[model samples]
Every structure is written in C-alpha cells, then in structure tokens.
Target: MNQRLKTIDLARGASVFIMIIVHTLWMFATPDLQGSSLFGTVIHILGKGTASFLVAMGISMALSRRQAPWLLAKRGAQLLLLGYVMNAAKFWLPIEVFNTMPESFINAYGWQSPLNSEQLKFMLLTGDILQLAGVSLVLFAVLNIARWKTHWIATLAVAIALSSEFVRGSQFTLLPYVSDLFFANNYQVYFPVFPWISAILTGYVLGRIYQQKQKDEQYLYKVCAWLGGALLIVGAAWLAVDFKGQFGNFFHLNGGGISYLIGLNLCALALLQYLFANKSSGPITRALLYASKHVTALYVIQWVLICWLMGVFGYHTLTLWPTLYLMVLVSLLTFAVHKLYLQSKRTTIGVMQKTKRTA
Candidate 1:
C-alpha cells in the first residue's frame, strides 16, 4: 500500500488556503461586509476547510501503518499540550502581557482592557481544532486497541451527528474542562468533539474502504463520485427546504449540514484525484504538497500572525480592500515564517546529532 496519498495532501493544502482566506475575513472585515456581502457568503460556504482537515486527518490515521496505541496516545498528548500553548500565545499574551489589543476591539467583544482571571481561563481552555483532534486521536487509540469494526465506528459517527443538536451548548460548570472539550457550544469551543468527531469517524470508515479499492484507482474514484453526488443532493435539498433548521450554526452543524460537508469533501477529493493523476509535478502542485506536509506548522504560524496583527488591523474595522490585501500579505508571511521554523528545527536536530556522534 502507498504510505501516503497525493490526493489527501492536495485536499489538505486546499483546505489550508481556504482557512487563510476565511480567518482573514473573520479577524478584520467590518460587520456589514462580513454579513451583507457576496464575498462574505462565499467565504462562509468555503469554511469547509476545518471539516476537510478533520476528515483528512481521520483518513490519514487509517492509512498509516503505525496503529500502535501507545504512539497514538503520545502524539495525542503532545497535541493537547500544544493546543494550550497556542491559546496562550494567540490570545493571552497579546491581550494581557503585551497589551497589543485595542480598547475598541476589547470593547467590541464585551471584554475589558485588562482581562480578568476568569476570562483568561476561558481563553486558555477554548476548544479549537487542535484540541478536538488531540482528544479524538486519544479516543481512537482506545477504539483501535479494542479492535472495533468499521461498521461500529460508522454507527457511532452517525449517532453523534444526529444527537449533537440535543446536547450542544449543554455545559457542566463543575467540569468546565471536559464540558468545553466535548459538550460546550460557546464561542470558546469552535470545534467541539460531539459533531466534529463524527466527520473524523466517517473519514476513518471511508479510508478503510479506500484501502481496499486503492489498487483499482478508477473504480475508487467512480464510487466516491457517485456516492458524493447522492449525499450532496440530499443535503442540499434539506437545506433548501429549511436552511436555519438544518444548518443552525456554522460551528455547530446539524446532521443535514454534516452530510453536506462530507459530500462536498468527497466530491472535492474525487475531482482533485482526477486532476492530479497525470500532473502531480507542476510547480503549483508541488507547492500545495509542501504546504500539506507542514499543515500543523502552517496553521500555528498563520494563526499567531493573524492574532498579533489584529492589534494593528483592529477587529472588524477593515473594508473589503484592506481585508483582501491583508489576506494575501498574511499568507505570504505565514509561508516565510513556516520555512524559517523548519530550517531552525533542522539545524537544531543536526547539532544534536553531531553532539551525539562526538560523544
């Protein structure tokens, strides 16, 4: 079996690009532009990057030969710790230590210039995509060790997606940490495990199928295309009938919205596979593949850049022109910073290896 799928890499790279555009809009665009413009509507729909990333992660986990429970556990723990570190760097340090955030921006969010301990705690504990992935991987380690069947996993995903609406936003004050990670529906919990984990589980099931059919590449793409189409039709029809009832909130997608996202991702995957089949060596393709390889690093660098830049931009104050300009600027800076980070890491590893050899 191929160790890595080029299509998956392309999908992730595409998602990263989408994420940059959407995040830039969120951090800088004025309320009217965000809510009332055609561009905003398009960006809102393209916010599938998060779903795509989670699904791709699940697929990767299944494709990987290293299914050792201990390894998964260790990696999951690292991500969990890193999520908090990101929260501190992106939110706490700028607001509290550096005082980089403008008073207007702080007031816009109904927060004081000097955030209190409670607010700081909330920031630190905010459930982001990294936290969701970390928790999911840890849980998957248990599931894998238990030797659960693919169908069982798929059933669990369906159940979670269907029942998410009932338990969403249901918080347990005493168990703030667990609640935020798994159940909370507030702003802090952007990628709660309830419904989002379903996407990962779905990817795992599909990944298993992909493994079986990968040898027959054409057959696999055909199957995915047809299945994706059917799901898209169902999801779109439901949304057309009652969008609010089905979609609810962007972060907290209902069953119908989840179906739509899954279908959309699958279709995109099939299309990408077709496109890259014979042209994988192009400069653009290579660039995307590079971005895919360094997804976590790119995500971290971009968010840190955007969060710090918020002080200069002022939250929700920019017009369409500046917002667009900043999006391009940030994307370039992220790539530059990500390259530097990789170089530093390589140099450190080399120095450590040299020391070990001498010893």
Candidate 2:
C-alpha cells in the first residue's frame, strides 16, 4: 500500500526507460543500422524481455492490495481508452506521407504496409501495452470479485497462452478487430496478449506468495533465488534445445523462450529486491524509482512522443551517429515530459482544492 515497494518500482521503472531507448532506436536508426540482423535480434530480445517483466510488476502491484480489484480495473480502462485514442490518431496521418518515406524507414519502424482503411482498422484493434495491461487488469479484477481464486486465474492464463499455439486458422487478417485480441494475425499488436497475460497472471501468483512472505527477507533472497534459478535453467534448456523453431518469435508466446525470460525476470526481480531492501540507493536507482512511481503517465507520454517523432516526422538523418543522438534526445524529452506531467498534476490538484474550499 505504501511507496515502500521500491523493488517492483525499480524493475518496472528501469524497464520503461529501456523501452523508450529501444523505441528510439526503432524510430531514429538509419537504414543500415536497422538492417543489421544482429542489432535487430538483440533489440528484439532486450525489448520483449524488459516489457514482460514490466507487465509482471504491474500485476504484482495490482494484486498487492486486498481492496484493489475495481480501482485497478478503472486504471486499466483509462489505459484502454488512451491506447484507442492514440492509435486512432494514426488515421489522420495521411498514407501519402508514409509513401514518401524511404522503404528502409518504413520497414525499420514496422510501418511497411501502406496506411489505409484496413491499416486504420488494424491499428484500432492492435493491443499496445496499455490495451493489454488494461485488459489484464480488468480480467484480473473481475476474477477477483467473482471469488474465482488465484489458482483458477493462473489456470485461465495458461489456457490463454496455450491457445496461441493450438488455436487454428489465421483469422486475425480476416477478422482484424475481433481476432486481434486473442491471437496474432493481421494485427501488428505488440506484446502478444495471450502469452503475455500468462506472464502477468503468473506474476499475480508470485505477488500473492510475496504478500504472504515479504516479512521474511530470507525467503525472498534465498528460497526465491533457488526457485528462480531453477526456472532460469528450465527456460535456458528449453531455448538451447529449440532456439530457432521455438524461441524464434520473442514477441509471440514461444513456449520455450517464455520459460527462459520468465526465469530471467524472476532472477532479476529477486536481485533487485535484495539490492533495494536496504535504505540507501544509487542515483540511477533513485531516478528509476521516481519514474516507476509514474508508470502509466510515463507510458502515455512515451506513446505520444513516439507518435510525434516516428509517425509525424518519421526519420531525419539516415546516418548512424544521428540515431544515437536521437535516442539521447528522446530520453531527454521523456524526462522533460515526466516533469511537466508532475507539474500539471500538482496544478490540477491545487485548482480542485481551491474550488472545494470556495464551495
């Protein structure tokens, strides 16, 4: 209930910041830089892994409370609305503009397909993090209220994950709006909802366990460390056995890679928890802790910024150095936006308080 949950904040905060960096690369990198297969693979792993952890932290936070179901769902709805509005604005960006951009520019940012009515429809249905997070929260909320119990919720998550592989017919293209939520098809929705939700629900289980045992610092570091290490091994073994055919699609729920990343996330989470359990933290951790406190705001801001940068301006210089420059610029801009948002919140609060007092 308190802001004392620095561990969760650190992971989510750090990941959100890393997410911005990856997105910056997607936006600013030149044709050559984007074309590098090695770069692409590394970026893909880094982005997806961090994002997975972020989502898990979100579930943990939501479940940390006994009276949180509705409140969390309300937050989820806000994210869903924001995602729809943000994605809907893409309709205004003329395809003619996109057509003028270089092919590499288009491909690098996953905007290769021509922007049209169908694209608009696809974007509308696409499950960005906000949408997925919203859906997950709402679903978790409903389940909690229904008294379905935590194990059942986790089972439902597993069902969703398995459905991605076993569910037949690529109806995502045919039924973009309808099918996009369930599985990957015509949709360019990042996060691959079904499998990702499994991660989230699993985190819910972890959170519930954590809630029960948080008072015992020994369990978090020693017992959780052993368990997390085992999971890491299983995930790694799974990846080693079938890296290409299985772990190939990092975004999609590759059954094996999910195991690997889940293990890695758990380990990272435990390590961070132990590290932050102390009173003192480094400047960087403190900064991340600050950002983690404003997760949703930072997310919405980054989305708006990415839209303006890549959707509006597209790419500027095609050189390599400029990409790094742009990434730095994006980080600076995000920090500024975070500050502005905090200021705006304070102003709104002051205005509301004044109005209340006058009444």
Q: What's each prediction's TM-score?
A: 0.94, 0.82
Candidate 2: tens digits of C-alpha lDDT, residues 13-92:
78777788788776666556766656645665578665345445544554455446878788778878988876655333
**Backbone clashes, each candidate:** 0, 0
Colliding residue pairs in candidate 1 = none
What shift in Å separates residue 353 of candidate 2 from its native position after superposition? 3.2
User: Predicted candidate 2: what Cα RMSD to the true structure?
Assistant: 3.8
The 10-residue segment of model 2 with minimum total lDDT is: 90-99
Of the candidates shown, which would achieve the greatest lDDT relative to the real structure? Answer: 1
Worst 10 residues of 1 by lDDT: 214-223
The lDDT of model 1 is 0.83
